[model samples]
Target chain A: MSSVSDRMLTSDPVVEVENLVAHYGSHKVLDGVNLTVNAGEIHIIMGGSGSGKSTLLRHLLGLRRVTSGRIRLLGHELDGVHRSELQELRKQIGVSFQGGALLSSMTVGENVTLPLREHTRLDESTMAIMARMKLEVVNLGGFEHFMPAQLSGGMIKRAALARAIVMDPKLLFFDEPSAGLDPVVSAELDELILRLREAMHMSIVVVTHELESAFRIADRMTVLDCGKILISDTADKVRNSANSRVQDLLNRRPRVEELDADAYLARLTGE
Target chain B: MPIWMHGSWMMAETRLGRVEQLGKRTLGLIAEVGYLAALLTESLYWIFAGVFQRQPVRVSSVFAEMMRTGVSAIPIVFLLSFSIGVMLAIQGIHTLRTFGAESQVVIGIALSISREFGPLITGIVVAGRTGSALAARIGTMVVSEEIDALRVMGIQPVRYLVSPVLLAMLVMLPALTIMADFAGLLGGAVYSAMDLGISYAAYADRVISVLKTGDIWQGLIKSAVFATVITLIGVANGFSVTGGAEGVGRATTRSVVLAISGIVIADMVFTWFLNR
Candidate 1:
């Protein structure tokens, strides 16, 4: 396996997020998050449930509006880009959702070829060949004829990955890639992520809560807590951090805070 | 003020709040309708742009939707229209007999079925069946993040998802109405012969004489408009879905209700205009 130094050849950052703030109605989810992903590196955004990692991912993908912040993807600022330009920008990015998000009505092959069919003027034969090649890359070879419903959880994830990379995007995003998969399958997916970086030279940003997967695959990682980033550095630096919250996360220890009884009662009763 | 007086004052304030809430809800409903109109306009823009730009229409998906929305609906539409036709004939017979104008029963059934019930009943059936299904399917897709996936692929959801279904509805609704009209007329003829002792030839002659081509055209036109309303409402609700599975269910129910109501209102407008 190539070291992080070898893959981080270019200093150009494919993704630059600065002081990003986001909200869900009245509730704030991401609070001043700053992140950068260098070209050809795998950057993992790891946090517990409701830690705003998913919200950050949504903002990065331009699926959600940022409350206050700047997000630059492939050198284009997403904050005020026109709709047509944003769409054109999206063609250079790929995302694999947590649930795979493959169209249930389409076969795996059809799903993979959808982007090409919509955007390219390639003949049907060329499109089919390209789709088959992507399926093979994700270890989903010969599964093209099957519907998404027929695939297992792991296969579904792989199929979604295949579709995401079918266009060979400059930047790729994965939301919980190894989630709900067995350890063996998860490890295989880790290997696939590494190979994709090596083969495609594409920057990858993955949002996950799986520490093992994060440690294994991330060239760099960010740890988010309560919608704020506690650490964003090399994986080794994050693992060796002296912060109690970071340690608690690394050691699988629950955060236990001492509470005042009166305050707790007041909060519960909205007094 | 005394404690009792304060309590009464609080109750009055609560009642005032309720009235204010009602007004707010009414305004919210009007806003939603305005938003839906905007969505319809955007969808129409994409549809026309696709046509003029020679974009590839997904023929297979449109055909599949046609099967689901039009073909699968045949049995229920036929059965319902047949029953309605029989009931109309029976009622017409009893009422006309009282006035010694029983022979006009055939004309009454023919005119009403062709000009009104044929399209209205077809629209209602489709709203309950295909419109609800469209909303549920797309709402589920939204909750599952499939819509986001499409966006990441640089494919517009309106073009990829809504357009094909819209095209299918446009083509199929009118066809279904024509089938329904024929089936209803057939049912009326059978009832006239068996229940009223009127010969089939006499009933057919009366229907042919009373039913103008203009009436059939009016029903077809009404159905076409209803098709647009049903599909636009369904796709709009689907896109607006939030939460999860429960949200999908709510959106589906709302689509059906709004589609049926919109169809009825559109029918009235079309009837008045077309007749005038």
Candidate 2:
């Protein structure tokens, strides 16, 4: 399991994006965003609704086509990398979507073992053992046979986490790991994420709008608003920043904007 | 332009807009055909390449699809084939009876069922049943992000999902066609014996004499083509799905409509070739 990532220096960037610009039709979704996640770190990207955090995460996962700039995952530039090469690189990276995305057709155990079956030739017994080990890591022990439909929302998230880490990815990206849950379950997930970083020795990038969870687990935090980075720094610095928009986000204040009569009329008339 | 001239200009603009829409539709169809070809090619590659690899085709998934696409479809195919078979025999008796040749009904039943109705009817049923199901299943997966999960896991969705279902369709559609043929024959036999006063032995002998190896092979061959068209269209429509639950419904409808059309068009071409 030892690889170049293990030997990399602490400051080495595992995930890097520079001047990344993206669009959905005529609307700009991500506007000149720059971000980096160093080796063995938890970098949280936090933003309010429609702030382009999801789109930025999609770009990092190589799931979206960008309009400009560079996205380098572990050293491979994703912009025009060969499909096969991208797939090869994907073996070392994992993603958990906001929805658990567990195949409804399969049981929880089968879901966890899916990546192994597709990509590895490990013996059946070994595969089972490794899947169980991952489930235990996520505190889902002895629930191997349960169906995903049978799991609670929190449990589904944990199960998705188990599947994501089953491959022991060097770079893990999890989307909204605490979006839907009781406060206690959300805290448990926060703790699990911290434990995962400690044990797996991997860089993790989490995308979320949950401020408390973001501050609790992030080694460094990047705050994005309306497709631009407001601040990228440690938790304390980001909170203390003098930026008005960042403060607005932190204090959960309502945004104020002067109305433009002509533009507003055009929008209303569907022009 | 003057106000009076603006009328003709608006008319011309409307005509041009229609043409532009037509052109876009034509291009969209062409792109969908391209998508179908790519999906089939990748599926075939994995099916062949899996021979050297250890169970890359995922036999369990294939069997599950077979149950849905073939085995579970047994009752509907049987009922339709049998009813069509009986109607064909009755009509043959009526037409031939005018010339005192009603006894020849077995030849018509045997030939038509084996050469035409078996594959065509079975294909229509499957396009409605399994084809729509395929689209709905994959469309749901796309909306739910399961497809993305598979992608991020380094597994190609077409390879992991489409290939196994395609293989199942390839194997099971032909088997259902054979069953359809048998059901049709039984229906004809029962009708001829009871209504036309034809003996069971006489009907069986006549059917055996009329049905040729070429007839069975032709039906089987058409079933294979129909199977390919149905799976390709279904999988393509599923991948093209957008939005959410509503998108899945649209994809399902498109898959059924397109696959049924493909079956009929292919059947027409095959019939033309046979006649030639």
Candidate 3:
């Protein structure tokens, strides 16, 4: 029943993205983006489709190359670092993909314990117990033998969350956690996200477009529009910002622009 | 400009454009070859290092691949080789009847099945089955973001995905070839008894006399080469797949075609060298 401020202690910055720019071919996807996530913080990134929030997350995860600028994760520079060192850095981080990317060939329990199996030589019994514990935390206990296809959308998301946190990663990145869920399930996921942060003391960065979920769980939030950050501030401040685009995003208003007759005629004529 | 001059200019321009297109294609081909070589080298390097570094050879994955590639393919390889053996016997009967050397059918079926058709038929069957399946499976994984998920988890995708299949193919292709060789010889023996009044004992005796140990070794060795090419092409096509489901489909088709072509080319080289 503690307030967010009472329970959260975010003093150390674990992720530092400085003027990060990225491109897909010649098309710029992330335009000089900067972000910081301190330890034990739950940072939400909000954007509509094609806003480049997902691209920025990919760059942060080092899945995509940076066009310019730098990113440091857990104090290791991402640019030009040796691959082995980057892999070592990656062991401390986890990502929950948008589609719940569980290996379809493996059972949920196997999926949850896969990271441990690959990286640790722990006893089979120990790994099983650890996987069950994480599954239980996600309210998916006793569903370990089920294939991922057997799970509902919400269950799949929860199972993915279980796998992401099974390794007790210091940093967690979740993409579109609530994209396909009902409001109730989304709320439950929001509750779980907050609980996970409080219990695990992990820094989390979530890229989502769901305003309700973002406002509910974000410790601090950033809103992105057209590959540019419209605002980055605490929940209360970001919600209250006077930026029109930010307001439009939160209020679900379509952007209105004055009509250009020449451009309209040109478009219509296929010129 | 004069009409004749313009005609000549257009023709000259078309020829120049064709040459430029050819150059571009050649460059693209070279780049693709380089990429494939790099992927193969990387996978082999990981396997080599993992073995020497005391890493366990992911027995379960390799075993699973072996079941899929080698075991599941048994029925088709056996059936096809048996059919080929029967046809070859019938043809041998007709051709050798002219010289009253129909007994030579024993040598033709035994030596050819052991040294050529056995590995060739097995290679084609595996190229159709395991090659396409591996490409489609890996390509779909790529499309579904499972591969990226693995990368994000700090696992080496090449080691986790490619190395197991490589080991499985290396072991299984030769095993299937040996199985096919026996199945084909059995078919020929069965036909020789019924059609040519040759007893199974006589057929076995002739096969034992003429089918040298070196002949069997040659087919097995050629099949091992087939395994390397099929796996490399399938995995390379898989890792290169782009877009979505359509991309996976394209990769699967390409894997089969290229693998079959690679097998034939490699087999021809082996045949030539052996004959020389």
As a whole number from 0 to 100, the lDDT of residue B86 in candidate 1 is 90
Candidate 2: residue A64 lDDT (0-100): 89
Stretches > 4 Å off in candidate 1: A1-10, B51-56, B195-202, B269-276
The better-scoring model by TM-score among 1 and 3 is 1
- After superposing candidate 2, which stretches have Cα over 4 Å from the reference? A1-9, A260-271, B50-55
Off by over 4 Å in 3: A1-10, A257-259, A264-271, B1-21, B51-55
TM-scores, in order shown? Answer: 0.94, 0.94, 0.93
Candidate 3 per-residue C-alpha lDDT over A1-271 given as tens digits, one digit per residue, 9 for 90 to 100: 2255334544657888999888889998888898887777788999999999989988888888898999999999999989778878888998999999888889999999998888788999999999999999999999999999899999988999999999899999999999889999999998998899889978889999999899888888989999989998888888999998899999999888776999889989999
**In angstroms, how far off is B99's CA in candidate 1?**
1.5
Instruction: Look at candidate 3 and tell me the lDDT of residue B184.
Output: 92
Candidate 1 local lDDT, B50-92, one digit each (tens): 6554454578878988999999999999998888889888999
User: Lowest-lDDT window of 10 residues in candidate 2 chain B?
Assistant: B50-59
Order of quality (DockQ): 1, 3, 2
Candidate 1 docking band: medium
Cα lDDT of candidate 2 equals 0.90
Question: RMSD (Cα, Å) of candidate 3?
Answer: 2.6
Query: What DockQ would candidate 3 receive versus the native complex?
Result: 0.66
**Candidate 1 similarity to native, TM-score:** 0.94
**What does candidate 2's lDDT look like per residue over A1-271, in tens digits?**
1232234435669989999999999999999999988888888999999999999998888888889999999989998999779878998998877889999999999999988888888899999999999999999999999999999999999999999999999999999988988899999999999898879988889999998999888878899999999999877788899999999999999789877999889989999
Worst 10 residues of 1 chain A by lDDT: A1-10
